[model samples]
Target: MSNKYEEIAQAAIKLFEQKGYHATSVQDIADEVGLQKGSLYHYISSKEELLMKITQQSISGFNRRLEKIIETQVSAKDRLILAIQNHVVSVAANLEMTTVLLREALSLEPEHHTVIKNETDRYLSLWAQIIDEGVKAGEFKPGNSRLIALAILGSCNWVYRWYQEGGKLTPEEIGSYFAHIFIDGIKK
Candidate 1:
């Protein structure tokens, strides 16, 4: 994407985070980016399209990083630690986008929603794969990998709701703490 387009997307994310997807207008986004309302369409077809772009970028980033972590030649326990850390750090670094993604994704058109849903499923499956590997290797106790993946992600994804930049724990520290909890919980 061009620098201008990126600027527009960032502006949209900010407005969406502040005023919400349903409440934010095209004019609001245009003003945020110093563009006229009509000119906003040059970069995006509609406000919803912009929402879709922001969400797609967020989920794709998570999947890409997790994919690399999954490919690393390490024990499943170590890999799971890395994955949890990656997720917490990513959520902290991109809080606005993450908030928009979590809170406003359902506002997308059906086709766009389907695209994000698929990407999300792919991401969940990556977590499931790690847990499954740990079970197969006898590192984690045998159980339903899919449900376990959901539980881990449910814990990690909630960081956005209460995260502060200079909070008691850094993102990595929080991530490591979470990793320890999860690893201990699942270990044989």
Candidate 2:
């Protein structure tokens, strides 16, 4: 992507995260990028297209990073920890883009909606496999990996609700705390 297009799309993502997808206008994005309303057309076909672009880039980047984690030689338990750590760090680094996916991806057109949803599902499937490995290896208790996967996903994915970069807990700290609770429950 051209630097100009990235700049404009990033601005659009920030606006979407702040005002939400429906509440934001093309003019709002243009102004955010310091572009004339008509000038935005040179880079994007429509506001929805810009939203699609942002969602695609964010999802693609996240998948790429997670794939690298999967290829590593780490054990399943550590891999699961790495997955949560990656998620928290990614969200902290790309809070606006993450928020856009969480809050606005569903409201997009059907085709784009399906595409993003599929990518999201693929991402979750990676974690499920890791959990399955742990269970099979007798590291984790025997149970539904899918449900455990979603529970772990829910914990990490919702970090956007209260995660502040400069807050008391760093993303690594949050990841560690979650990993401890997930890998070992509170019971004796």
Candidate 3:
């Protein structure tokens, strides 16, 4: 992405994360980026348009990572653990952006919402496929792989809401703990 685009996106994400999407105005983002609101419009047609771009850009990067992780010549269980770890770290690193996605993405215009939803569904499918492979290989327990995938992923997404940057657990610690809980169960 262009530096201008990155600057605009970072500003927008921070604003959206802090003040929320509806509360944050184009002017706020422009001020954050040191651009005139009119000039900001030159780069983005509208605030909603910018939101869509940010959502898509953030997710597409993660999707690329997921694609690579899934393609690794590793056991399905190993891939799932790795995917969980990466998901946790990525969400923690981009907490604000991820929060915007979790909280503000649904408020997009219908077409934009559909685009984001489809991308999300595709990502969920990847998780399901990994779980399915594990089940088939007699690695993970057999049940609803899709539901299990959702539970695992939903837990990760919820992290943005409660995560403190310097809190008790680091991202890797949280990721590993979550993976262990999902893969091995909480019963001791």
Candidate 4:
């Protein structure tokens, strides 16, 4: 994407996070990016298109990261730690996009929603695969891998709600803390 397109997407994410998708209009996004509403259409077809782009980009980036971690030859326990840390750090770094995704993703049209859902399911499956590997290797107690994956992702995703830049913990520190909690909870 061009720098201007990136600027527009960032502006849309900020507005969507602050005022919400339903409440935020194309005009609001255009004003945020210092462009006329008509000119904004040159970059995006509609407000929902912008929302879908932001949501897809954030989830796809994390999915790619998780896929790499899953493929590593490390122990499942180590992979899980890395996965948790990656998630927490990603959520913290993209809080505005994360918040917009959590709040407005369902607002997408049905076809768009389905695409996002499939991408999300792939992400969840990667987490479950790590847990399953750990259980099979006697590194973690036997349990529903899918459920455990959801629990870990839920905890990490919620960091966007309270994360502050220059808060008590840096993103990496918070990620490490979450990794420790999950590792201890699941370790055999």
Candidate 5:
């Protein structure tokens, strides 16, 4: 059950991941969607616009989902674990979209990249806040919380590169491993 725009967006994400955003043409996307090249424009303005949409949609979804998890009235350690699991599940569940978002974001125009960068910072700061909360409670060691958040995010983002749809490990399993490493290594 998908609308024309959703269909087009998904196709573009696949093409972007396979051929890259710079190399992917509207014609390529149109072909993938079995639409006449010109008809694709009826749905989307431009390829750059499509990239911006994909970039925005991907990060925005992550932000919303992660924000809800972080806002839960639970221990920072519990919240952090849930957040990590949520991150991995989202990435694993939407591999192509996530891949396109991660790999193609940098090729966006400066203005678009700036927006994505800010969204990214906001998302990562959720992890930092969790870490900071834990430190204040003396449940975790204090250091550079932002650095720790970035390291966790960096490690999780790597899932886009190699996570297979039918891989041996589940997203929960991968996320647990990441949470274990971060929490175990940092806990007081």
Candidate 6:
């Protein structure tokens, strides 16, 4: 990404996280990035466009990472856990981007929303397929693979809200815990 685009995205994330998408304006991001209002337009067309770009960029990064993970020939269980680890670790590594993705991504234009949603659906479907394979192999219990996949994704995605660096649970530790919960339900 160009430095200008990065600057604008970072500023928008901070503003969006603090004041939210509806309240933030292009001038606000421009002020945050030390650029004039007109100069901001040169880098981005509109505040919504900037929001979409930021969201799309984050989603694309995640898709790329997950694609690499899917290509690995690990066991289904191991692959699921690895996916959790990569998601958590990558979120931790890119905190602002992750926050933009989870918290502010929904406020984009309809077309942009569809693009991200489609990519997300594909990612979820891959996880569901892995879980289905595990169930067939007797490694996972019989259940709704799609719902289970959604639960795992939701559980992992929500961590960015409370997770902190150098906290009691590291990303790997958190990833393992999540994997345990997914593989074995909370029943005794």
| For every candidate, C-alpha RMSD to the true structure in Å | 0.7, 1.8, 1.9, 1.0, 1.5, 2.3
Q: After TM-score superposition, what is the CA distance of residue 55 in candidate 2 from its true location, in Å?
A: 1.1
Steric collisions counted per model? 0, 0, 0, 0, 0, 0
> lDDT of all predictions, in order shown?
0.95, 0.86, 0.89, 0.92, 0.90, 0.83
Give per-residue lDDT, candidate 1, residue 85: 97
* lDDT string, candidate 6, 1-188, tens digits: 68988878889988987888889988889899999999888889898887788778888888888888778888778888888888888888878777877887788878888988898888788888878877877777888889988888888888888888899988989988888777666111
Per-model TM-score, in order, reads: 0.98, 0.95, 0.95, 0.96, 0.96, 0.90
**lDDT per residue as tens, model 2, 1-188:** 78989899888888899899999999998888898989989989998898888898888887888889888897778888898898888888889999998889988899999999999889888878888887777777777777888998899889988898799989989988998888885111
* Highest TM-score scorer: 1
Clashing pairs in 6: none
Model 5 lDDT on a 0 to 1 scale: 0.90
> In candidate 5, what residue range of length 10 has the lowest lDDT sum?
1-10
Pairs clashing in candidate 5? none
Ranking by TM-score: 1, 4, 5, 3, 2, 6
lDDT score, candidate 2 = 0.86
Model 1 spans > 4 angstroms off? none
**lDDT tens readout by residue for model 5, 41-148:** 889989999999999999999999988987899888988889888899899999988998898899999999999999998998878988999999988998999999
Q: Could you tell me which residue pairs clash in candidate 4?
A: none
Error of 6 at 184 (Å): 2.8
lDDT, candidate 5, at 176: 95
Ranking by lDDT: 1, 4, 5, 3, 2, 6
Give the Cα error of residue 137 in candidate 3, in Å. Answer: 0.9
